[model samples]
Target: MSYLKFDKDLMINLEYSLYRNILRTNRKGAYQNTSISGCNTSKYQGLLVMPVPFLDDDNHLILSSIDETVIQHGAQFNLGIHKYNDDNYSPKGHKYIREYNIDSVPKTIYRVGGVILSKEIMFSSKENRLMIRYKLMDAHSPTTMRFKPCMAFRNISQLTRQNDQVDRSYREVENGISTSMYYGYPEFFMQFNKRVDFMYQPYWNQGVEYIQDMQNGDTFKEDLYVPGYFEMPIAKGEEVIFSAGDILVNTSALTDEFNAELKKRTPRSSFYNCLKNSAHQFYYIPKTDEMYLLAGYPWFKVRARDQFVSLPGCTLSVGRPDDFTKIMDSAIPHIQDFLNDKPRKNIIKQIDDPDVLLWVTWALQQYWKENKPVFKEKYVDFLFSIIDFILSNKHPNLTVDPENGLVSTYGRDVAVSWMNAVQNGKPVTPRSGYLVEFNALWHNALKFAEEVAAATNKEVLATTYEEKALKAQQSFIETFLNDAGYLYDYVDGTYADRNVRPNMIFAVSMDYSPLDRRQKKLVIDFVTKELLTPVGIRSLSPKGYNYRPRYAGTSEEKEYAYFNGCAFPWLIGAYIEAYLKVFSMSGLSLADRVMIELEDQMQNDCIGTLSEFYDSSPPFYAHGGYSFAMSVSETLRAKRLIRSFG
Candidate 1:
């Protein structure tokens, strides 16, 4: 009865099947991703991609993939596919695939000769462990299953080459073998529930080309070090569970542990539940004592803006106050960095984004609205500190314009807000001064902070923030509105970006909307006429001069097209909020249609989860990161909003 399944017709069609992928996460920052047919089509695709604590705290593909073959009556059927150099797919294991289903776990059934085998893949919730259960449903005779374990032991973002430094030797444990290619890498342990004999033959799987990487202008071909195969006798009705982890484990208890972890999962009956379940995949508790979110699967790390933007939907909407509190508490320090504009390393330096602070305040406001706290002294002080930082305008790159009370990027070369798509060290969309969404969130933050301050009995702070918010509102309404009925996307000196974009939707979507009912209707109508798409709202309306309909080609080309016209599924949530705000419950029909459109996308790139973006043109092909946290979380939020209206 599961709707998420692919039959042999589609499974055997590489043109269609190769584009479709599957992802499994451990909720602790580790994940497994590959093509639906178990082919490694992308460098980010792997059987075991986990964060290695000892090796600089980045996700590494310790195990690239494992291929399974069935030996019955001396005939072998390889149920594994790999793309070699020059775009050659060896063994062509997908040809034997009968069915593939992604319900709870990714299950693939293969029919070879008279033997039918089913493989189910699952990951442990709290640990870096992956379990693959193989069941022989129907077979004419006993079958010998051989598994070849391919180990990369390199960063997921990088590729590996065949080298003599790789250690071929492996230590045999109680019911498994532990292997590591080099020093500083976590030793990977592969074990099985049933007794099996491991062959000592080791070889290099060279020229394994990740097609998607080549298309992205990255190192596509990699050399995988695969130690010998494990041969086990499996009869009809017999099941075998294969487990892999960073540390040694008791093989016998893996099944029971996996089952117990399964018991902890919420039931996924609807598309909303599916998205809600995937939202948990992004939740990570690293060395930081508080919970954080990884932006996306198989690649991205924790980002300040992404975490804050996704927090309310991923946690608060699910009625998880404890998770919300942990996430907010952990994120406060990062938001402070944005306010302070303190220098940091690579990605953290991006905290200077004016929108990060806005998102943080908005998240806190949403949290406070849901559960009115009795003024926790520490949290209240934190709120006051944020207000002080924003009003002081001490940051080097960001400043609050005293005249307008609007926040803007101080430097000329800086891309402060989320429309940040940089190429060759220059912003694709140079939205430097007073971005539409930034000022909208800015107004909302100040208003929310004023309320917070008043609730905490700090009357002076409340009055100051109230005055500042009103000033910003006055300037925003006077300066940003255009004759076209939509607010300008950004205003930097005399150059005002008068593009139709989803950024203006936040003006009316937030709780303390700065726009009046009439203006809200104008903005909503403008967006609906131009920016709205089936998947989400486009970054720039096609009617604009700068709109890019497609997101494709080289890294530089894609980066240029990133925010220029790419459609973000997360923005759909704001569009829904704006629709409901402008038309009240009467807008439920349109909002429901938007939500349903996004729901259909759960079956696309990453099954049961939404992608980060899509093309702005017809069909709106999903692109960017697969299993994006914001996409999943915001979809859940939009669904909740529509249901509430109903």
Candidate 2:
């Protein structure tokens, strides 16, 4: 498959200023201007406005600039004129200019200037004009932008209808004139109602309010301005200045017209430039060849450790070998720590965190799979040390019941995996007994270690892990399997939770010993019957008591409910793998059919793309959309699974 196909004629020009503000403009009367400003309680962020022109005649046009500004801090900064465009533009003749003063005041000022960025635009063939989009970041903080707007039109015909006819709706309205606002000073208002939603992080300390009014009719008008700050501490020779002339445009007409205008404008490959730029932004460029390191989300920075966990299949398996090397090299220090019995915690602290360990181990295995020469010469010792640590440290507190092979995590306030939840400074899933998925991962880890040891001629270590793997396998079958042939959710002697969830799929799909044909069929049956959704796999079966349909509440309540019933698209990749494995084992056609169904479902339900998650209810609502790097990467992986079966 060709991964680098570029539409050369697409003239979607996007540029960013020194202040990191964006400007986009196209030939089809579509333009977007955005910036970042303010600090403290009055700080706010979002697109200033999107201009859509209505043509009265070929010579005369009616253009409207829908300007929007967000306040970040609560009543800290006051309104000012800032600057005006007339100072730079000298109109030829018969040109009209008007400036409707916007109110910028104490309510919008804050300590940190609101940061607003723009997404790459794909011109619409149907819209004749361009459609633009903008977002309000970090809205749930102590103070947020109030979204003051002003409509500026020059050389325009008068509007026949009143201001109410303009269709000015707020907070997710597509083409209407309605005004809705959020109440907190620093809260977010999501765009594209169907695709994304916001979840407040536990650390944020702010509120938000969204306001809009269509009171002015045709000429030009300004809404109330709330003041805020965009404060960044500068070093000794540091200074910041603002420029006001860049414009962003993405229109189908412009993209189509680019082919004719290409030679006249610049002598360069626009398509190649776009791809190169995208590749650079999506993954770190130059340093890592094919490895796509995620720059955390828009609000966060690129984390080295998180990238290592997702690098193997997410980057290497997708054909970026250069990126693979960079990721491995970057992770060597942390990899050595895992080998030396000092595994790193979530941050930089040297404490044994199992999820990080699992990620490091997985990366090592993938590196070995791709490049054997480096594996033997450089990684052999590192691999063994990781294996030794897992075998020795992981099982110390884990107690295996005499009758069953179930291993329970026993330690003070330790939740082992990434699902580790701390509520009010207390560990929530402090499960002292057998947890289902953790052991499944443990079993796979041991089996992988055994393979690596045997390959490296370390028979003594290989035999030890092999024995442990067999014992765990035997115990897993005995304790977890019920009369129905499907596995129990978790086991603690008298307590065996029988929830039908997606966690069990890992055991069936991983490199551990395979389940019996009947057991595999039963697992597929249970999962397909209860957990599948249109966009992805549900975290838990709806029939389970703890399942909740909606995922909205206070921070504490939402955090507690995150795992109970939320649907995750990444898990669907696992389901596809598990289904294929079961089909191969049982010689069943149902699993193959479901794989096809899932692929079609993903494309249609998720805005012609995939996302991090979706609502679990029917016609599953797409959430956390917008180029979720993992969602696209995993869907590509799942596509490979179907192809391999074929």
Q: How do the predictions measure up, each by TM-score?
A: 0.96, 0.55
Give Cα-based local distance difference scores for all models: 0.82, 0.43
> Could you tell me which 10 consecutive residues in candidate 2 have the lowest summed lDDT?
97-106
TM accuracy, model 2: 0.55
* Model 1 deviation from native, Cα RMSD in Å: 2.0
Candidate 2 lDDT (Cα, 0 to 1): 0.43
Q: How well is each residue in 255-361 modelled by candidate 1, as lDDT tens digits?
A: 78767766776555578778878888888876548678888876778877888888989997777778888877776676665556554544333565566667777
* Residue 412 in candidate 1, Cα distance off native in Å: 3.6
Q: On a 0 to 100 scale, what is the lDDT of residue 627 in model 2?
A: 29
Which regions in candidate 1 have their CA more than 4 angstroms from the true location? 334-349, 374-378
C-alpha RMSD of each candidate structure in angstroms: 2.0, 17.7
> Which candidate comes out best when scored by lDDT?
1
For residues 1-646, write the lDDT of model 2, one tens digit per residue.
Answer: 1221112121111111102222222222222322211110011112222122232211111112222223344443322112113322111100110111111100111112443222122222212222332323223344332222222221222222222323222332221122222221111122221221222111111122111101111122222222111222222222111111112222223434322332322111232222122222335332222223552222212344345444654555556665667656655665565555474533223224544555566667667767877678877776667656555554345444444444566533765544455677666544446666667766777788888789888899889878887888877787677887677766655778787767777667665643676787788688778887755677778988878655556556555655666676666656777777766635335545544544443223211234446668865654432224455544555655666666
